[model samples]
Target: MIIHGNRFTLRPDADAAQIEEALESLRNQGRVIPSVKSFVVGRDFGGEYEWGATFMIEDLQGYWEYLVHPAHRNTDQVGLPLVDKFASFDITDDPDPEMGAKIAALHQRRYDSDATLTQLVSDLGEYKGSAAPGAHGER
Candidate 1:
């Protein structure tokens, strides 16, 4: 499995509403693309990029297909112009048991005294069992 994402900073004069409309259109277009397993776009609350999109693909070929799809291409034509700069990455699933253990131990320490955080970790742990690779906390 592969996770692909892009982060974009909107142009100073870019219209937020119009950009959202364009993103929605792109999302609609993405739904029909065979290569895309799932896709999501959202605004960052407080991050380096103002807007971002994330999607999962089955493999490298699927990733290539998604990149060349007319809908995706069109979205780039319309949306790229509204951005000041952008960065993208494609991540493939590569798990390290040691890292996973360390992460779990860290979470345990951080959340052990907090009810909300404990519950969140418990929920994610339960969900991870049934989720796909790279989904939830699955390694």
Candidate 2:
């Protein structure tokens, strides 16, 4: 499965009601893609960022499906006009499915490691949306 961390900035001035409307809309939209195995949107209570949601996608294609879905396009309708963008980190495991827990633990460690400072610096050097740092010919 691929895990994508989506960050959105609701219209800077949007009130709590507007934010709820956007989140509720996503919840009510039902399944937009078959591969969207599971996803839940919620306010980012964490003080670090504005808002974010973790999506569990069955595959890259499934992630694309939801990206182009009409429901996603309507983000502005519910008052979330500013999409800070998304940070998608692929998670892969070995052959043994029974090792899921161990794999998750490893992945969590990777996520928590502060070594990402190097990546953060590199990304800042030439960041563009969420693609590669120096991917030319890309929008």
- Which structure among the candidates has the greatest TM-score? 1
Question: Which regions of candidate 2 deviate over 4 angstroms?
Answer: 9-12, 45-47, 76-79, 82-139
In terms of lDDT, model 1 sits at 0.59
List, residue by residue over 3-52, the lDDT tens digit for candidate 2. 55545444456577766777766664445655567776776775544566
Pairs of residues clashing in candidate 2: none
- Candidate with top lDDT is 1
Q: On residues 8-69, what C-alpha lDDT tens digit does candidate 1 reach at each position?
A: 67777878786986687568656977999998888865777777788888765676567557
Using all chains and alpha carbons, the TM-scores for the candidates as numbered come to 0.62, 0.53
| Per-residue lDDT of 132 in model 2 | 24
> Which stretches in model 1 have alpha-carbon errors above 4 Å?
94-139
| lDDT agreement of model 2 with the native | 0.48
Worst 10 residues of 2 by lDDT: 130-139
